[model samples]
Target: MNESALLAILLSLASAVGYALAAVGQSRLAAQGGGGMGQLLTRPLWWWAVGLNAAGALMHVAALHYGPLTLVQPLGALTLVAALPLSAYYARRRVTRREWRGAAWTLAGLTGLIAVTGPASPGDALSLSEALAIAAATALLLAFLVRAGAHSSRGTGLGHATASGIASGVASALTQTVTASLSHALPGGPLPWWGTSLVAVLVATFAVGGLLLSQAAYRGGLAAPLAVVNIANPAAAAVIGVALLGESFHGGPLGWLTAAASAAVAARGVIMLTGATPADLPTPLPTVLPTELPAPEPAVRITA
Candidate 1:
């Protein structure tokens, strides 16, 4: 392999390791189960996890800069395999067989999906309409996930984890689109002046959502939930690539079959993970509510 490719691979692996450590660390904090977001903010481990997460992102960005998307993204699936044993391990929880199976299936499926993702279209920028459609779709999905999570006890973490993956995927898609638009030749001259910045804003919004949701998912075990995020992220991105980014499956009908099978396998893995790692009750934090005012308010109305 060329030096660039080799460097990208090494960086990707390092990125995977960083993400695994960060996820496991956050999982440890969530498993302790003490306080709310306020308390979570005070914990040192949380900050460490955040720092590691940032480091992982930097590594990933560097990898992407150095290598092709097809190479960099596929290697990202390594995070699933790496996080398998690290989940809640700090809490002295042993890895379960079910978690192992889930991780294997997830990794296999994600690998297959990446293999078939094919290359992005040369020099194409996402149209404004396409970006809007993606935004609308993700918004609806997030709303549904949040509402669904609210009613079901077990589904809460799963829902948030799923939302995290989708948000991250969408954010990535937008990021790639905006970045490509700036550097590459656009078919229609250029994207509008505000278009790139608007997409950047969207990217930030969804990236933050992804970060928070994934943290919420760690309230249970990191392995399964992290697996879910890993699977969903690439799956969602592949869909965007094919539908909106002018990428296509290779090998015609066979490629489509492979894609479908990979998706099903990934979905099954997610299902298994949700059942395997049941969510612990989240620590309830205080919510601000209006306290009852004295009857003196009636006197003020009368005076007015």
Candidate 2:
């Protein structure tokens, strides 16, 4: 493989590892009944998760340096596939069969998305006007979600997952914007102040939004919300990339049809996961007997 391809693969792997660690940490926090933004910001474990995420973002930028945005962006979707088994194995959580099916469909849709999308050129950059428009639109959408999320009660799994998905999508979009700005403004020279400012804003937005969404997702059930967020975020990014960034697919109408079909498969996965209930799977029970249990004589006295 070429150097760029090698770099892309390495970055994808790094992103996968980073996402896994972050997911595990976030899930643990939720299980422990961590509160909203305040708890997340104060916890040392949360900071560790944030650091892992930052490292992943750094690797993602490095991958973009070598590979097409079309390629690198889609590979990030692999996080959905990676998180499922990782949660099950490391976190000792059971993944329902339905969840697995849903994950499969989601992956299929994403794979089709990647295959159908046209290749992106290295160092592709957006105009300032376009960047501002995208930023504004994303901000507006986030505001709407925040308003909607506020009314949602705690422990509402689906609501939390939906909110988390929106946050993740916005974060992904902001990251793309930052990547585009940095790539264009810093070519062969010192970085511009405006570009640096954009990067910082995007990074902070991504981190904060992602952290909240992740915590909410864990409370809602890690696998389902995770599956939804992972699929939805990339799907949104792919659409934006195609429409705004001039990405296209080969094979004309047939290709579009195929892409649609792939998306359907992915949607199926998300649907399956959403329908899953914890009762459908076996729960781990306490293995050790209670030390304070009454003696056998109590049982004999109760016989009537």
Candidate 3:
């Protein structure tokens, strides 16, 4: 990989860690039940979560500046691995064998994805009309998901978590477009004020909206919902990148097969961890991920 690709990978990792930490904090807040909106705003943890999320997003934009969406998107799944120890530390949760195994699978799949991808160079950005169309569609989808999530309280928050992932994924794609376009304008390219303003509104809307939805999804607990969110976010971004942004897979058929297989492995790991909570914690975690994570041999016991 070139320097740009390497830097993108590093930035993506930093962003993932930030997001993972933030999600843990948010999950803790959810565990406490509704703190009332005002009370929540007054809490230090809430601010930390919000601040970390914003920091992650800014870095994500930078990573997208140098990397292809496919490469950067998959790397975000590492957040789960990173979140494990944090979850344990904060919630006094034990790392179950199932959790470890799932984390291992997620790590393995992401590694394969990286190996298959090549260096990324800056690519085409979406035009105003195209972005607007995407924005409209995203808005409608999010509306439906939010309603589904609100009703999912007694059950798994899978629907809510999925919505967060989609919102976040779309925001990431638009961030790339806006970043490229604005950079182009900086070099004397024509800047359309209307386009700039419109996309900005949409980006802000989705970014903040995704964060809020993720907070709601955490009402149950953290594991399953986090996994779903991470997988969905990357999948959404990869689709938009390939279908609309003219991005393509780096390797040929063999590489594609590897990526597909790796993804399946990761998904399986997610399932293994779906309902496993700490023995000490009584409440179930909400299901899907914010930037989420791991690796290793058999240092820890593997349980069914």
TM-score of each prediction: 0.83, 0.74, 0.77
In TM-score terms, which candidate is top? Answer: 1
The list of candidate 2 runs beyond 4 A from truth reads: 1-7, 66-75, 91-94, 122-124, 146-203, 281-304
TM-score, cand. 3:
0.77
Candidate 2 lDDT tens digits, 87-159: 7776556676777787778777877877777654545444445556766776676556656656644335545
- In order, the Cα lDDT scores of the candidates are 0.81, 0.68, 0.76
Once fitted onto the true fold, the runs of candidate 1 whose alpha carbons sit more than 4 angstroms away are 34-36, 278-304
Per-residue CA lDDT of model 3 for 77-148, tens digit only, reads: 678888888888886657777778878876777567656654324556566777788888888987877776
Q: RMSD per prediction, one decimal?
A: 11.3, 5.6, 13.3
In candidate 1, the residue pairs with backbone N, CA or C atoms under 3 Å apart (3 or more residues apart, or in different chains) clash, namely none
Per-residue error for 243 in candidate 2, Å, reads 3.6
- Tell me the number of clashing residue pairs for each predicted model: 0, 2, 18
Clashing pairs in 2: 102-269, 105-266
